[model samples]
Target chain A: MIRVNNITKTFAEREIFSNVSFSIPDAKIYALVADNGVGKTTLLRTIANIYNADSGNVVSSAKVSYLPEERGLPLEQKVFDFLLFVAQLRGMRKKIAKTRITDLLKKYSLFEFADFYIGNLSKGMQQKIQFLSVIIDNPKVLILDEPFSGIDEKNKELFWEELLELKNNGASILISAHKTDDLTHFCDAFLLFDGKSIEMVDSLQLQVEQK
Target chain B: MINSIRIIWLVAKNEMKQMFRQRLFVFLLFILTICAISDPGKENLYFMFFVLNFSMALFRSIASEKESRLAEYYISIFSPTKLLLGKIKAYAIFFFVISLLINICAVAGLLRFVDVSFLPCVSMLCGWQVFVQLLGCVFYLSLVAFGASYSRVHTEMQGSIFVIAILMVSSYFVVENLADIFGNVLLCETLLKYIPFTMPFVKGVGILPMCVSFVAIIFILKFSGKIYKKRLFYYGKNKITEG
Candidate 1:
């Protein structure tokens, strides 16, 4: 489980969010919804420890996998090498990392381009690679920021399936996306960030309200 | 500890692979090696050039990571200390191997072309100079890396790189004319020899200054890590950590 307790973040005296508190239990997926600059990405980063919360803490019992919103993978690195490097940094042994990366690539139909430079791939292909890197180590908790930004409908379906698999495997996932309609279909609940605080609502409740 | 070492080694290996993949970088390394043997008398100038070039590399690496937001992702995986030390370790190995090769080639060129009789004296002097200069390279590189942490983009690194380049060049000139600059003050000369920037060039000093350089390197690297951690996620003057 991942628990964010009373987190606050401000930039240059401008308060983005304050005392934001929420939790994601095991084997569930939650969507973070907010308008642009409303601290959706910032909240995700704080949980991932990429950015420290101003007045609170995020507590996770195990390794947390994070996929930043942007295309931050090293362009010069080959896909396999980049994944291996990240896995090792996350404390995975080389043999296991290699095995898992291969399996993931094959599953994603990216094994043919395993040795290709990441910069050479199309935008959607690169997004797939980035997502593969995120799930390579079987993380216990995941914090993904706008992971569906640059992909097509078919790839989006693939991602949803993968996320469902991860959730069913007892992983806690917190994902932020602009499309609440897509998230309502599978996400267990929603954490709506409205600039000052967060309100947790059940996914069924969201669908009902939308109807 | 072993895990940390493994992580550092992985980072270093990755960096080495990335650098070697660049044909221009490889060509430059070749040119540098050739230059070392062709002009043994200008080894001091070569050392300065090496510092300048590698400092640029460090600046570019750090700046580009910040610009591309890759540093943010890296920070989440490992401590900034590990990332920075891994980077420093990669360049240290590169500098050590290349400089050792250059020293060997310069000595070989001297024996074959200049004078065989000068072997004993030249060997001892070159040996000590190489050791001292290696320490100097790490020291300066750490300083540059620390300064590079302040930059948010590649272009923003110009101010720090300029200042560091000037410091490195001035240190070279200062070492070249030590006697003229100090003018017979033994205590002053001894003190100057311990300053991390010039310590690499001042020979004949004992192990004490070497230890001092080690301390300086450790201190600089630790401070650099702290700065990097602070700057990595910072958006502006608000100081995100303090928000």
Candidate 2:
């Protein structure tokens, strides 16, 4: 479980958020819905502890991972070389991580492109590899900021399946986006920001539970 | 320890791939080789130095991603320290190989055509060039990595580190190369051994500075990690963590 209490952040003179607070229960998929430039990325960064909040406390386990809203791949790095590196940084051995990379590359349907550099691949392919860089480690607190933004419908379906698998295994997901309908299937509840504060749609029923 | 090694290893491997495989890395190698071989006599060292600084700047651009907003994705999974090690290690290798290449070309050209036995000198000179350039590269790499880590702009890493290169080179020469006294006379040569940077040159390509260099690397390894954790400055602004 992740508990965020009274968090606030500002950029220069602009206030991004003010004492916003919420809790993400274990095994729950919380979609952070808001229009653009409302500090969606900032909030996700704060949650990932990549950005320190001006006020409030964020409590969570150490087993957390974040997928930034922007592209982070080293364009010259081959797909397999990159993800194995991420796994290593998070405490996996090189040999062990390389073995895992083989499994993940195939699973992501990237087996053919495993040796190909990211710059040579399409955006969605790179994005999927970027996602694989995080998910290969099996983070308990899975934070993805606008991961679906640039992906096509077919690729999004592939991502949805991988994410749903994580959710079923008791992962807590924090996803921020402008589109609500595309994510209605897996989101257990919704968190909305109206540019001032954050409010959770606590009573919304999950598709499975409602059925 | 193992995890950090793995990350750093991958970082070095990736950088080597970029330096060797891509059309750009190959183009750079060709340009640098032309510069190294085409120059006449000891003047080649001057061209090699230009190539040295050029390669350093190039690697800086490649290594700057770890410092920018682009770093946000990777930094979440890897600690700032591990990330720093990876980048530092990668760029160091880039500088190392290219500088070694320069040293070899210079020595071989001096020995083959001029008959100075660069092969006899390669062991001593390679040792000196590798360790010295490696040290210089890490110092620059750390500064760039820190700037990139703290900046929203990825390209800022290149600018920030490069702008300080003149100062860095000045310091490196004044402190490190000053010791040899450029192989001068007896009275001065005796005293040169006592000056830290000057004294290492008396060892004449021994492990003297190499040992000290390792200590400095460890110091950077330990200090930068603490700086990021206690001070959340990676957001392009400083925010102290208050309990």
Candidate 3:
């Protein structure tokens, strides 16, 4: 569903990573594990077309929903307003967006928090809101950076459940997480991210190309 | 594009919330009205000038979020052109409401004190002022949006370069007024021709200036859209996005 070749990103004359290349298989959970500034988010940006590749190309057949590790949620935002905005952006109508947001809120036990300002909630809760903002749309591909950081264990578990359900429902997932141990269970394969090199990581065969 | 529009509206609606969340909007209107009404005779024009400066300062606050990473979340997703348009739309509505209130106040205050003939000046003055301010907002935010998109540090301050630029561009207008004291209307006319800001305004009985403003908006919109398209590194100065 996605192919990236020799994608290089630099900031301030310093190279973040170079010659990064990979292809995400259809309907599989692809985990891109790396330390901060190792070009994980930059790589995702390239795939999402937020940042262009310096010397390579990323070809993707699926629409992508990108979730950055940062606190992307506006704290003063209302849950309904926030989710509805995201849903509508993915091309949902206002009424459909409203209905979808209501269902997601209730399903996630966020019904009571729907009207609460994001800033008034705990950081974990706010993170969930941010996640919902992206996931509510159900894009063909999900690219997440640090998807499990900063949330409560319960919320984290809920995220895993939701992710597995998404995967089962034919959505390809690519994620970067701090906890490499928990990833072995669901993530079919990963990209090894060191400071200068992003290696294709698999007990199975992996493709490599340089731009 | 629908996605872009929805996202822009969300961000803009939130921006409006932020505007109202702070008491500054109401405070500015209140202070301006009080100043206009309390003025004594022709001295009110002096107060009116102060109101202009105050409004400029108030409107500049709209760019504050872009200066900070506060707007970054949405910035990462939407096209820069749409983002700029949405923010400007919200600010336009804000300025329109404020302009309406200020116009009403100015007309009432002027009728109560200055020559009642000043009533005719209301529509013209307010129209010109609103147009000029809108021009300033567009010009300033276009650059600020660039700074936010590209600059690595202290973008808030970097965004002010646009505001300072407006000041510099309009500085020639000031010179024309001062030169008139010496009955140097010819020199003022000649100087105004070469000056960038004055040139646009007087090229054809305000038509040139209006056309220039509209053209400038299209230019900025086109440029920002190009950045959204072919440009890899936006925050045009920021290399972070350079692949």
Q: Name the top DockQ candidate.
A: 1
Candidate 1 lDDT score at position A179: 59
Model 3 regions lying over 4 Å from their true place:
A35-37, A195-211, B1-10, B33-70, B100-133, B141-152, B155-205, B218-243
Q: Which candidate comes out best when scored by lDDT?
A: 1
Query: Best by TM-score, which number?
Result: 1
Please, what are the lDDT tens digits per residue for candidate 1 over residues A21-47?
888999999999888988888778778
lDDT per residue as tens, model 3, A130-209: 78887886666888878887677899888988888888877888988654576776777877878566666652434222
Q: Supply candidate 3's per-residue lDDT for B3.
A: 60
Put down candidate 2 lDDT per residue, A15-121, tens digits, no spaces.
Answer: 88888888888888899999998888888888887877888989996567888876567876778877876787677777988988899888778999998978899
How well does each candidate reproduce the native contacts, as fnat?
0.54, 0.50, 0.19
Q: Clash pairs of candidate 3? A: A54-B243, A75-A119, B149-B235, B150-B235
Instruction: Tell me which of candidates 1 and 3 scores higher on DockQ.
Output: 1
CAPRI band for model 2:
acceptable
Q: Go through the candidates in order and give each one's C-alpha lDDT.
A: 0.82, 0.67, 0.62
User: What DockQ does each prediction reach against the true complex?
Assistant: 0.49, 0.33, 0.28
| Model 2 spans with C-alpha error above 4 angstroms | A93-108, A203-211, B22-69, B91-133, B144-162, B168-243
What level of docking quality does candidate 3 show?
Answer: acceptable
